[model samples]
Target: MKNFTRVLLAALLVASFAATAQDEESPALSISGSVDAYYRVNLNGTNDERTGGTIAPGTSFANKTGFALGMANLIVGLDGEKTGFVADLAFGPRGTDAVFGSTTASSSIVNQLYAYWNVSDAVTLTVGNFNTFLGYEVISPTANFNYSTSYMFSYGPFSHSGLKADMAFGDFSVMLGVFNPTDLTDFNPTGRYLGGVQLGYGGVYLNFLFDDDFFQADLTAGWDLGESFYLGVNATTASDSFYGGALYLQNSFSDDFSLGLRGEYFSDQGVGAITFEENVIDLTLSANYSIGNLTIIPEIRTDIYSADEVIEDADGIDVSGDPINPTYGSNLSSFTIAAVYAF
Candidate 1:
């Protein structure tokens, strides 16, 4: 961990020196970032004493029912005339969780480290690791209207490492990419590659990805109703009977205050060790109050489950030394208060 930090500091020093030595004609470097913290209290009082059912489901930012640091994100970028790069770093729970296969806490700081080159006015190429383009929700809390995430975004790929081309034609644009296996950040485990395509026009976008016989598709659409209201929708489905959809609506009553709501539904097929039907419905209502660079978000979320699987429990019926808790009608609800400062 110390070595990694030293390398990062060295890279920053070199970049700073190079930027200082550049002439006025060189593109200026830009720095921007956001930091967020939040507190949450779950109505279910879920505990991890038994292991499977204690953790809050679907809520990523405020997974615990107390004050926590979401992330301290620092983004630096340089856009030259024909070549540029972006280096993003983060340190917190959100950052650690977004890294591919990052199960335990560590000192990895890189969230996105990618460079791009402009091939022409309409074509560009980018390489290295970047955030996944498959879902509407992102890892950044400042970018999302709701603090809690959806099932689709929570379970989907967080980032990809590979190369891709971005092409624009009139009002339509396309992105084609070849990526390493899902959730792989440091190295590629297999020789197989995942291919992705993003097609967009106006306020509507469609994405498709395929990997080793498994395919996923996503669609996102946005519309502005006059100047005060907006509507957005996201629907995604993957092979193996995994699918989810979310509807978002927001209304701005004032310049600094707005109300937003999201309704979602998700389902998972019995493909793993568990063999029971599973379905989830969640609803979240959130409010945003902006005060200059700082924004306050207060949200309420509820989740309902329709499942027949039995999870391991501590005091339930024992089977081979493992107790089972029937999870047929269990549900969860929580409230969060979060604040974000961006520059």
Candidate 2:
């Protein structure tokens, strides 16, 4: 940790010197941000009222049946001719959990704080904390197609702190870095390092990441069939125990309205003492309506489980241990409505 801190400080000093020597005019600072909120409901009656808990299928942000605060974000940035810095901060439930791994009041609040020096037209160096280069979906609600999330995106690494060098060759660009462990948001480093690479060509992108205990490779492709139709896909795998993928399609009827559909499949290889593995498939359909700066999303999702494990009741009894909850059951459903305002 100490060595990492020393390296970061030295990098900052070098960036300041280069900026001062390269440009004489002052750079203007910029600000931008977004806010979001949502409501959710489980249609399968999966709520355990005795415990005030609900088990919604797949990965969901608004887990409860009432209105909820999603997040409010603020970003401040400055750019010189050859140097730049960004400070992104967030507040509310989703943002807090993304940084601290929980919704606790006392925790780190900074999402990303990084400084970069453009070495040349094709090379750049960046240091400090930044978003992970591993997934297609982001933590912010305003960037996702559906209001709810997927199992793969929810379990993947969210952010990292490191020093990276990027080089570009026309349509191809690559980035490599080394630094702390996976989800450490605080300044306490783990003395470990991670490596990441991104390769892109027009509409197709591939990402690779590796660490001591985990390795992930993902691919995303987007195509515009016409002015009113689009297609997208994401396939990802992590370690030896998990793999998942999703297909997305959208149709635009007008400038103010559109609809999207997403279908996904996920599998788990299981763990010790657990005799059964899990295979699940889900489908989601959503609509987007734009009104100036605010966009509203109404989404419905359904999940189908391939195996019959056990379902516990409110008192923690295995209601499905002997086929009691429902002799043959394998489906769950949910709905959510979200509003996001970006500026």
Candidate 3:
């Protein structure tokens, strides 16, 4: 027993020394990441998904009843007081392509890889692939509050590759980037990364991206009304390729209980100049009660689509209204309820 204890101590000492050596070799490097999983059944789909049972659409339970859909990210960063660098890797099931044997479109591997070097307290330069500055929500599900993404979030400019820079002072920062267009497979462009900027101060933020083929602009702001009530508003307008934006408000009466309501209006111009008008107003409310390690979350949501929004023909699908192969514009009104847990 004494010999075993000595051996264990020696192993621990070696690990400590290795870690020290690593720290000395890269004094600025740090690693951090997060994983999130949820079981969600969409009641808006069909009876097959909404069957009333344990984790059904309308039940209250600790475990969500659905497939394990989630996201994970690993961020490797380096810092040296005023200067810093970051590389992020993203992966999950929701974004995989069905042709690759995935239920949904989830890409595999390090899709988002970028490096930024801070040159001064007020400015920094970045290169590689990164997310575009355009939405209220992001691609990372672990960082989002809702299980399903909004219409605006699904169709916005995703990312860019090339030279980017950010300037910061006080509570406001301005970012500008140029990227190469890589079609649908990637965010960076083949010749340029496009060009974009975000300007914000206090509770408000605005972003703009302009390219030879397209231009996009978004305005967003949030107000925290005292203890638990807050209001958030955002709007987006883009040239023919994308259409999505929402204005909403959220409130929390207590630590374990909260509610949210939002009104959304959207429209999209698909690839090759096919246009679809989308206007909708959605109402969603959710309640959560926590007990120790278990949390009971019940949510209710409703959506109403505008009359002029549905399309009868789309080239991507052979006759758009056909249910056998409906495109993204076929259904405008859909609702969902889910219960989730964290372990």
Highest lDDT: give the candidate number: 1
Q: Write the per-residue lDDT of candidate 1 for residues 1-343, one digit (tens) a residue.
A: 2343234334433433443343435689999999999988765534444334454665455677577789999999999877788998888888887884633344267888887777679987777778898888998888899988887888777888777778899889998777777767656767666777899999788998776577889998889977999999999988855788999999999999999999998887643311334778889999999999999999998877676322222344455644455343356677889999999
TM-score of 3: 0.67
TM-score against native, each model: 0.82, 0.83, 0.67
The candidate 2 region of ten consecutive residues with least summed lDDT is 320-329
Q: Indicate which candidate wins on TM-score.
A: 2
Cα deviation of 136, candidate 2, in Å: 1.2
Error of 3 at 328 (Å): 18
For residues 78-153, write the lDDT of model 2, one tens digit per residue.
9877888999888888777778642334446788888888888988888878888776678877788887877667
CA lDDT, every model vs. true structure: 0.76, 0.73, 0.52
User: Which has the higher lDDT value, candidate number 2 or candidate number 3?
Assistant: 2
Relative to the unseen true structure, what is the C-alpha lDDT of residue 165 in candidate 2, on a scale of 0 to 100? Answer: 71
Scored against the true structure, residue 210 in model 3 reaches a CA lDDT of 66
